[model samples]
Each structure stands twice: as structure tokens, then as C-alpha cells.
Target: MISMRHVVFMNVAEELSFSKASQLLFISQPAISKHIQLLEEQYQTKLFERKGLHIELTTAGKLLYERLQAVKEIEHKTEFDISVLHDAIQAKGNLKLGASTTVALYILPKVLSTFHSQYQQIDISVLNRNSESVKEALLAKQINLGIIEENSKVNQIQYTPFITDKVIAVCSSKSKLLKKKNYSIQDLPHLPIALREVGSGTLAVLKRALAKHKINFAQLNVKVRLGGTEALKNFLLESDSLGFLPKISIAKELKAGELKEVFIDGLALQRQFFFIERKGETSDLNKGFIKMAKSIYNL
Candidate 1:
């Protein structure tokens, strides 16, 4: 097990405030300070530098944090492995999972339910964010595994294909644009488009697809940028502005005549969802979950 001092230090590093760390860890502020002070004394060096009201981890502190994270990961793995040895049929442990908004909202629910039914002993927690944030969480050791839509290869991360998702341009069913069965690529720049935020995997795929057709994203008139799939869908429903979204996400809306897919001639937008993890960091529990998800999704 990791030391309490290390745990306090991690919370402080992440929160950047002793008071916040205290609240998060359910401890007193003075105790949090004492733990840090003891850790600094044992290391014989300053772990953090105070910048006015804020504190930043020093170089040594950053190194220590990384080492502690590795230690914690190993410890968790060891506990899980030992548990499995004693109870081969029912693995018992906690799994921290991160997933991008699309995968978290659309893909993971049913799979997670099935996983929970089969392995009720294993506790599962999910962190939902965009693909970029999910990657960051995985790198920071905040999550053991991630499901993301972006396939841009990161050298420090390993990725495997999880599933294929299609993105399509859509507008409110009441929009005048629905009169046309198909639109020319040139019509895209003239339409007011609502797109996902910069870090989104949907936007990444859209940009790549646009670039493939020799069109620049800046050429399109973007009226609004949304942070989530649902928000964009809602925006589309309230206005005539065009938005691109995952086909799976708007299935119910499409069937209900709330949104209609608009096809652009000579344009096909598709991206693959990926199972991502820090390179060389796969654990047995991670593999087990991955196998189960793949079986559930038939990927």
C-alpha cells in the first residue's frame, strides 16, 4: 500500500491547493500540511514552491509524483492479481476507466452493464471527458484505460480499434435545407455550421475529411462551437444552422423527425473508436475488461 503522505501529496499536486486537497481527501488542512512537511523533510528538499496563493510542484516533486503513481499502479495490480489467484472465477478490484464523451454516452453504457452483471465484485468508476482529456488522464495515471474516438497516434500511448462510427451533417427537420436530398461540397462554406470544440474527436475527423477534399475549416462559417454532442444536437434543433454529429448519437432524434441527416456529395465522414492505454502499462484487469468489451460489442 502507498503511504498516506504520498496520497496527500498527490491530491495537493492535482488540486494545487492544500484546502482543496483536505476537502477532497476528507482531512484537515493542518494534517495535509503536516503530511507534505514530513515528506519534504524525509526527502530533504522542497517539494513545492509557493507562488502567491498557489503552489506548484518543484522538479523533484514532479519526479516523486511520477514514481509514486507507478508505485500505486503496481500495488493495485498486485492486489488484483492476488485476489484473482484466490478467486479465479470472480475477480474483485476497482477499475478506473476514462472515455471520450461519445463513447462514454453512446457505446459504454450497455457494455458496462454487461460487465457489471458478470463481474459484480469488481468496482468500476468512469471519468467522462473529451478524447484529448481522456488521453491526458491516461498519461497522468488518473485512469487505467480509455476509450477514445481520435486515432492520431501518440508515441507514448498504444491504441487498438474498438469500433467504427460515422459522422453526418444534420439540421432541424424544419430547416429549409431539407428540401434538397444532397448538397454539393461547395454549399458547406455557405452554411452556418455549429461544430464541436477544438479537442473533440468529432471535430478532428471532420477537419481531416474537409482537408482531404481540399477545403479548409476556416472557410466554413462557424456560428457556434459546442462542448458536447447533445448540446450541438439541441442547438441544431433550435436553429437552422448545420451541425455534424455521430450518427449513433442522433438515432432517436432522427427517427422522431427532430433532426435529418444531410448528405454532402463526395464527402464521407467516418472515424474509428480506439481502446487506448499508456504504452507498456497494460494490467491483467485492463486486458480482461478489454476482452469483455470487445466480445460485447463484437469488435
Candidate 2:
């Protein structure tokens, strides 16, 4: 079994902030300091250097952190193994997961809830970010798994198809852009549009669809680039700016008539969402989670 001190230290190393690590671990700053001090004493080396608000790990600290990361993974796997040996139907352990904005808001809740119901003793935490952030979390080993809109081509990560979605062009009922029965991609150059930021799955699909219509995004009259789907939806509701978003992400708003899907000729944007993880690492917990996700999505 790994010590709590080691776990706490790993959290601190990952967060690079004592306060943030303490908050995440539900401990106080002083307690975090004590853990760090204990770890340093055991290693007989300084683990971190403090400079203003930022902290940097010493060489020894970096080495220790890398080992501790593997220790944490082994510790988690051992616990799950014990539970299985005991025939616990609900596989109980910590599951750290990340998801892009669209998947987090639309797809994950139902799937995670169902998994939790069967494994009531398991603790799950999810971080919501864009696809790039999700990829970062996986590479850092900060999250054990991730669900992302397929946008990147990172060679170190393995991606499996989780689900697919369609991008819908939407506008406020008050927006004049909806007046056109069939707007072509060429017509998009004339309207001010709101868009998801680069590296987002929605943006990736939209870019490809535009290329098919021979329209360069550089020429479009973009009003703003929003970070997340919710931000884009809120902006769309309050302004005349046309936006493209996942159809699943705006079901409620569209049902209530807060927004309407605008039709575009020669455009039917579809993209897959992928479950991603570091290549060559596997565990029963990770496999279980993937199985649950696949079953939930009926894939």
C-alpha cells in the first residue's frame, strides 16, 4: 500500500500549488506542508523550490514524482483486484476522467450515472475541458481516461470511437439569418458568426465542411471565438451571431424555441467522439469503465 503522504505529494506535484492540492485532497495547507516535509526527510533531498507563487520540482523531486505516479496506478489496481476477489459486483475505486465540453454536458451524465449505480462504492471525478485540455490531462496522467471530440493527432495516445454527433447551425429566433430557407456556405462569408475555438471538435468538423464548399475560414466574418459550447449557446441566445454547435448539446434550448437550427446547403457536418488514454497502459478499472461506456452508448 502506498502512503497517504506520497499520494498528497503527487497531488501537490501535479497541481504545483500547495493550496490547490490541499483543496483537492480536503486537507489544509499546513497539512500539505507536513506531508511534503515528511517526504523530503524520507528521500533525504529537497523536492521543490519555491519562487513567489510558483513552485518547481527539483531533479530528485521529478524522479520521485514519476515513480509515485506508477505507485498510485498500482495501488488503485490492487484495490480493484481485492474487490473482485471478494466478489463485489460494484467495482469500487477512484476514477479520474476528463471530457470535452460537448460530451460532458450532453453524453457523460447519463453514462456515468448508470455506471455509478452499479458500482455505488466507486468514487468518480470528471474534469470538463476542450479536446486539447483533455489530451493534456491524459498525457500528464492526471486523468485515467478521457472522452473527447476527435480533433487531434497525438501519436502517444490511443483513441477509440465513443460516439458521433452532428453539428447544427443555430441562431436566435430574433436573428435575421434564419429568414433564408437555404443558406449556402458561400453565404456564410457575409454574416458575422460566433465559433468554437481551434482544437475543438465542433470547430474541426465545421472547418472541413467549409472546405468542401470551397470557403476558407480566414475569409469568414467571425465575430468571436468562444471557448465552450455553453458559452457559444448563451452568446447565440443573446445576439444575432450565428453559431454552429453539436445538436445534442442544445436539445433543451432548441426544444424550448430559444434557438433554431439554420439550414445550410451542401453541409452535413458529422464527427466522432473518442475515448482516449495513454498507449500501452491498461487496468481492470480502465477496462471496466470502457465496457460500461460502450454498453451505455450501445456501441
Candidate 3:
């Protein structure tokens, strides 16, 4: 087991802010400093250094953070294995899940509902972020499992195909863009479009699909960039620009005639969602939660 001082240090190292760590661990800033001071005294070296307005990890701090991450992973795995060894159904533990905007908003709600119904004893927490941020959170050991729309084979992580999603171009049903009878990829550069912010899976997938036809993202007239899927969807509702969004997100809007999906010739915007994790993570709780998520989608 890791020491309390080390736990405090780890939180500080991850957050890179003493006050932030204090807030997260529900301790006062001075107490947080005391723990770090004790750790530095024990180690005979400085773990962090102050630079003007902020702090950064020293070389020794980096080493300790990396080793402690491994220790924490092992500790979590062992505890879960022992706790759930006799009865998984009644096991009490925590599952931290990280998902991108689309998965968090659309895919995981039903999955979470069903999982909670069976494993009521287990507690679950979810962090919603863009695809890239989700991957960073996994690397930081902030979450045990993640579901993202990006299919990139990032190193040190494993991806399991979860569900298939499609990105469809859309505009408000009453917009002038809908006045056109037919659309093609060639017309995209001339159209004003709203895109998701950088690091979003939807934006990444859209760029790749557009690239196949010798079209670059800069060529399109992007009117606005929104951070979340729902934000972009809602923005498109009030704007005249075209936007690409996950089919699942706008299904209700499409059916209600609030938004109209524009079909472009030879452009297929299909994408695969994946359940991702650290390559060697072996928590049964993680596996069981993933199993439940996949089962709900029948994939």
C-alpha cells in the first residue's frame, strides 16, 4: 500500500497545482505542503519546484509519479480481485469511466442504467471529455475505463470495437441550405460549416473522410467551433451553416424535422467507437464493466 504522503504527492503531481490537490483531497493547502515537505525530507531531494506563478515536477518527482502510478494500478487490481473473489455481484468498489462527448451523452446512458440495476453495490463515476482528453485521463490513471469515437491505435493502450457510429452533415430544416435539391463533396468548400473543437473525435473523423476526396479542412468556411456535441448541434439549429454530427445525437431532431441530414456523393462518414484501456490493466471490475457496456450494444 502507498503511504498517505505519497498519495498526497501523487495527487499534486497529477494536478500540478498544490491548491488543486488540496481541493481534490479535501485537505488544506498548508497540510498538502506539509505532506510534500515530509516526502522530500524522506527522499533527501526536492520533488517539486516553484517557478513564479506555478509549480513543476522535479526529475525525482517525475520518477516517483511514474512508479507510484504502477503501484496504484497493481494495488487497485489486487484489491478488486480479492474483494470480488467470492461474489462479484455484491462486490463494493468504484468504477471510474471516461468517455467522449458522444458516448457520454448518447451511448452510455442505457448501458449505465442496466449496469447499475445489476451491480447496485458498485459505484460508478464518469468524466466527459473530448477523445484526446479521454486518452490523456487514461494515461494519468484518472479513469479505469474509457469509451471514445476515435479508432487511432495509440501506443500503450488497447482498443476494443464498441459500436459503429456515423457522422452526417446537417442543417436546420428551415435553412436555405435545404433548398438545394442535391449536394456533393465539391460543394462543401463553398458552404459555411460549424465544426467541433479540436481534439473531438467527430471532427477528427470528419477531416479524414474529407481528405480522401483531396479536400482539406481549411478549405471549408467554418463559421463556428463548439466544444461539445450538443453545443454544436444546438448552434447549428440557430445558424444557417452546415455541420457534421453523430447520427445518434441528432436522431430525435432529424425525425422531428428540426434538422435535415444532407447526403454528399461518395462521402461515407461512418466511424467505429472503441473501449480503450491501458495495455496491461487487469482489473476484473474493469473487464466486467466493459462486458456490460458491450452487451448492451449487442456488439
Candidate 4:
């Protein structure tokens, strides 16, 4: 077991701010200092030094932090092994998951709700970001596992196909663009449009689809770019602008006559979501959640 003092020191080292570490640990700043002091005394080496108003990890701190990361991997492996010795539903531990906006807002909740009903002792937290951010978070060790719409093919990470998805161009049901039964991809430059921001997997897939016909993404008459799916979806509802969104995101809106899907000749935007983790990792918590998600969605 790791010492509380060491935990405090590691948190402070990771954050480089006592105040931030205190807030993260729900302890006072002075108590954070006391723990760090104890840890430094135990090692007889200063773990941190002030580089300004902010603190920076000293060489000793860096070494200790790297070592602690190794220890953490071992600890999690031990916990995972021990937990599997019993029935999985009876196990107790924390799970951290990162997912892109579509999965977090739509796909994940159903799985989480059902998983929690069976394993009430397990604590769960989710980080919602775009697919690229989710990938970066998993690589940074900020999340134990990630569900992403983009598979970057990085060698250090393993990807398992979760589900297939498609992005369709859509606009408000009342928009004038609907006057035409079907629009060609060539007409996109004339249509006012909203778009998801760069680094978004939705945008990435759309870009690839556009490139198939030798079209450049920059040629579109994009009026605005939003950072999230809901933002772009809402923007389309209020303004009669065209935008591409995941089919899963706007299903209800499409059914309710609030939005209408626009067909583009020869432009197909489709992608597959993947469950990603560190290479060679076989944590039971990660497997259990993946299995649960697949089962919940009947995939």
C-alpha cells in the first residue's frame, strides 16, 4: 500500500501547486505541505522547489514520480488479479473512462447505468472530450481506457473495434436547401455551413470523404465552427445552416421534424469507434466495461 504522505507528495509533484493538490485531495494547503515535508524527510531529499509563484518538481521528485508510476501499474495489476479471483460483480475498485462527445453523451450512459446496477461498489468517472483529446488523455494516463471515433494507429496503443457510425449532412427541416430532393457535393461551396472544429474525429472523417473526390475541406462555405456535436446540432436547428453530425446524435430530432438529413451524391462519411488501451494491458475492469458496452448496445 502507498503511504498517504507519499500520495500527497505525488499529487503535488504532478500538479506543481499545493493549492491545486489540496483541492484535488480535499485537504487544506497547510496539511498538503505537512505531508510533503514528511515525505521529504523520509527520503532526506527535497522533492520540489519554487520556480516562481508556481512550484516545479526537483530532480529527486522527477525520479520518485517515475518510480511511482511503475508502482501504480503493479498495484493496479495486483488489484485486477485479486478481484478476478471472485465474481466480477462483487469486486470493488475505481474505473476511469474517456470518450469522445458522441459516445459520452449518448452511447456511454446506457452502458454505465446498466453496469452500475450490477457493480454498485465500483466507483466510475468519465472524461468527455473529442476523439483526439480522448486519445491524448489515454496516452497521458489520465484515463484507464478510452472510446474513440478515430484510430490514429499509434504503435503504443491497442485498438479494438467497438461500433460503426456514420456522419450525415443535415439542416433544419424548414431550411430552403430541402427544396432540392438531393444535392451534389459540388453544391456544398454554395451552401452556408457549420462545422466541427479541427481535431474532431467527425471532422477528420468528413475531410477524408471529401478528399476522395479531390475536393479540399477549405473550399466549403463554413460560416462557423463549433467544438462539440450538440453545439453544431443546436446551431443547425436555430440557423438554417448545413452541418455534418453523427447519425446517432440527431436521430430523435430527425424523427421529430426538427432536422432533416441531406443526401450528398458520392460523399459518404462513415467511421468506426474503437476501444483503446495501453498495449499488452489486460485489466479486468477494462474488459468488463467493454463487454458491458457491447452487450448493452447488442453489438
Candidate 5:
């Protein structure tokens, strides 16, 4: 097992604050300070220099931080490998999961249900949030694993393709644009548009697609920006404005004629969902869950 002091030091090194590290490690500030003090005393090296209210890692601290990352990676991998073998011998335990809005709503439920039925003893907890928030939760160690749209370029996270889905323009049947099967990007300026909030995976995907077409997102003429899929769906159902959403999200509504999907000529908006985790190694539960999910999803 890794030393508690080393773990605390790495957390503090990553966060650069005693308070944030404490919150992350579920320890108090004084406890965090004591652990850091112990590590520094044992090594006889200063780890951090105080800069105003901020703490900056010294050269020796940076070296130890890098070494700790490698050590933790090895430790995690060994433990996971053992767990994998143990699970193969007897599969039992709990799995904690996190997913972006689209995956939670349209993709994971059925898969999770099937996994539960097969492995009746394996408990599952799924935390739902937007992609960016899900990533943050994973980074904070609040979740063991996460599925999200590919929006991050952070080197510390690993992204593996989970599945592909499309985002389409949807509106109430009462929308003036309902009569058209295809509309140009230029025509979107005339319609009242509903959009997802900033930092949302859906919004990020949409922005990237629009940028490829040389369209400025600021010129989209949005009527409102909603916080979640449910909110955006409700607003679209009650208004004539159009909104972009994952196809899987409104499958039932579209079939029921409550919403209509619109397309743009020469513009294809497809986003790939990815399984993400902190870069380095994965545990047995993490590997198992991802493999099982992909098999179930036919990915």
C-alpha cells in the first residue's frame, strides 16, 4: 500500500492548496499539514514555498510528485489486476459510475439494467451530469469511471471511443420550419434557437461543428440557453423555436409527433461518446464495467 503521507502530498501538489487537498482526501487542514510536514521532515527537503496565499512546489517537491505519480500508477495497476483475477473467480461487489447527460438518458440505463440482472450481486451507482462536470467529478475522485462526449484536450485524462451518435435540430411541430426536410445553415439565423448552457458537452459539439462550417456561434440568434436536456426538451415542446439535441434523447417524442427533426444541407453533426479516466492505469472494476458496457451497447 502507498503511504498516506505520500498520497496527501501528491493531492496537495496537484491542487496547490491545503484546503482543496483536504476536501479531496476527506481530511482536515491540520491533518493535511501534519502529513506534509512528516514527508518534508523525513526527506529533509522543502516541498513548497509560500507565495502569498498560494503554495508552489519546490524542485525537490516536483521530483517527488513525478515519482509519486509513477508509484501510484503501478500500485493501482497491481491492485486492479488482482481484483480482475478475483472477479473472474467470483464476480461480486459494487461499481460506481458517472456519465454525461446523453449517455445517462439514452444509452446507459438499458445496459446497466442488463449488467445488474446478470451480476445480481454487483451494485451500481450512476451519477449523471454534463460531460464537463462529469470529467470534473472523475478528476476529484468522486466517481470511479465516466462516459462523456469528447470535449477535453487535457493530457491527464484518457479518452477511448465508446459510441457514436448524432445531434439534430428538433422543434415543435408548430415550428414554421417544420415543412422543410432540409434547411441551410444560413436559414437558421431566421429561427428562434434554443441551446444548451456553456461548458455543456452538447454545446461544445455543436460549436465545433458550426465552426467547421465557418459559422460564428455568436451569430446563431439563440432565444435561450438551458441547463440540461430535460429543460431544453420542455422548452422546445412548448415553443416554436428549434433546439439541437442527441437523437437518442427524443426518440419517443419524435415518434409521438411532439417534436420534428430538421437537417442542414452539407452540415453533418455527429459526436462520439468516450469513456474517460485519469491517465495512467485502471482498476479491475473499471476495466470490467467498460468492457461489459461496450459489449452490451454493441460498440
Candidate 6:
């Protein structure tokens, strides 16, 4: 169990305003201040720094926040386990899930539907964000599990390979770029490209692959940066710009003749989707879901 001061500090750290923390906790502003003061005195370090009307966590505070977040997750999991063991409630429990855009949009719908049908008692909530943001949410305990495609590894999180996905360069069927007998990877920089915005897992993979070929992202003529995969696909259908998307996502369009895959002689863009959770932390619910997903996807 965490102390009252620790809870107060977390609230203030998240909100970045003592008054907002007080309102969130339903405590007096002076009481919130006193609790933080006591914590600071005990630690013999300043936890926050004031910048005009805003407040930000100091180095020490940031460290404490990270540890405390883990503690909170453990506590939450403990309570959930106990409830599942004892309570005769109608609803089994809630599963908080976070996923990157690709997984959320292209992958999870059918899996989620099947899971819901099989386990109607379990309530599910999903938060969708970029891969980096999904990882951050998992670490902050805002989500119990995450599915992402980022290649960069974080020590605090453990990644289990979920599924293999490929990112391929694609264009509208009407694009003139298809007139060439063969497209070479070297020709990519001169073509008009539409890419996912920064922080996207697809974009990350594209950059790493390009770097291996001695190509910089700035060398590509990026005409637009879209935030969602669906939006990027729509943009491709309207314009002649080339874009990279998950093969699974564009299957329908490719079959319908609205889009065509642009093959570069030497370029093969592939990435793996991962089941992410905090290192050394696992719950029965998360384990069951991961198992079900693997079975459903035949992975």
C-alpha cells in the first residue's frame, strides 16, 4: 500500500498544478501542499520546480513517479486477483488495453469480437495511440497490456512476438510510377511520398530500413504526413504520392484494384507486432488474452 503523501505527490505530478490535484483528490489545497512539503523534507530534495504558473517534476520526482507507478500497478493487480477469487459478481472484470494505430485499426477488431463473444463477462476498454505513446501508457499503468510495432527496445518493458507484418510501398493504381519496368530502391527519394507522422512504428521501421541503404528521410520528397493508416490509404487513392502501409491493412484495396503494390528491387520492409507489458509483471487476465490472441491469429 502507498502512503497518502505518495498518492498526493502522484496526483500533483500528473496534473502539474497543486490546485488541480486538490480538486482531483477532493482535498484542501493547503493540505496538498503540506503533504508534498513533508515528502520533500523526508527525502531532503525538491520534487518539483515552479515555472511561472506551471509546475514540472524534478529529476528526483521523476524517478519516484516511475517507481510509484509500478507499485500502483502491482497493487491494482493484487486487488483484481483477489476480487476474481472471491466475488460472485456478474461481470468477470475489466481489461484495460492500449494498442498502436495499426494493431488497433487493422488487427484487433475480429479478435476483440471473438473474445467478447467467448468471454461476455469480461469488460474491455481500448486506448489507441502511436507506438511510443502506447508504451508510455503501459509504463504509467494507464493500460494493462499493449500491442505495438516499434523496433527500439525499452529495458523496463518485456516484448513477446505476436505476429509478423510487412510494410510495403504502395500507390494508387492510376499512378504513373507503375509505368516503369522495374522500380529500384534508389529511385524512392525522387518520388513524391506520403508517410505516417513521426512517432509511428511504420515510420520508424521505414527510417531504419532506409538508413541501411545509405538514404536519409530528408532525401525523400514527403508531400504529406498522415496520422492514421486509413487516412494515408485514402490520401494514396486521391493522389499519385507513394506511401508505406501494412500489407494486412491494404489487402482489400489491393484486391479491388484501387491500389497496387510498388515493389523496390532490393527493399523489403517487415516488422513484428509485439505483446508488451512491464518487465516481470504478469496478470492472469493479460495472460489469458495473449494466449487467445495467439491462437486466433494462428501465431
Query: Per-residue lDDT of 1-299 in model 1, one digit per residue for the tens?
Result: 88899999999988889999999999999999999999999999999999997899999999998899898889888878988898855777779999999999999999899888877788899999999999999987889999999747899999978889899999999998888898998789998899999899999998998898899889999999999998999999999899999999999999999999998998899999999989998989989889989998787
- Between prediction 4 and prediction 6, the one with superior TM-score is 4
Best by lDDT: 1
lDDT tens per residue, model 5, 41-84: 99999999999989999999999987886666566556546655
Steric clash pairs (candidate 4): none
Candidate numbers, best lDDT first, in rank order: 1, 6, 3, 2, 4, 5
Q: Which of the two candidates, 1 or 4, achieves a greater lDDT against the reference? A: 1
Better of 5 and 6 by TM-score: 6
Estimate TM-scores for all models.
Answer: 0.94, 0.89, 0.90, 0.94, 0.72, 0.79
Residue 44 in model 4: lDDT? 95
Q: Sort by TM-score, best first: what order?
A: 4, 1, 3, 2, 6, 5
- Clash pairs (backbone) in predicted model 6: none
Over 1-299, each residue of candidate 4 has an lDDT whose tens digit, in order, gives 77798788789878889999999999999999999888889899999998778888889999998788767766775775687677666677778899999999978889999999998877799999998888888887778899999736889899989999889999999898899989898888899999998889999998888888888888999999999999999999999899999999999999999999998998888999999998986587889889989987788
Cα lDDT of model 2 by residue, 113-157, tens digit = 988888888889999998888899899888989999876579999
User: Model 1: how far is 146 from its true place, Å?
Assistant: 0.9
TM-score of 1: 0.94
Better of 4 and 5 by TM-score: 4
Tens digits of per-residue lDDT for model 3 on 8-84? 99999988999999999999999999999999999999999999989999999999999998888777677667767
The lDDT for every candidate, in the order shown, is: 0.91, 0.88, 0.89, 0.88, 0.84, 0.90
Error of 3 at 285 (Å): 1.6
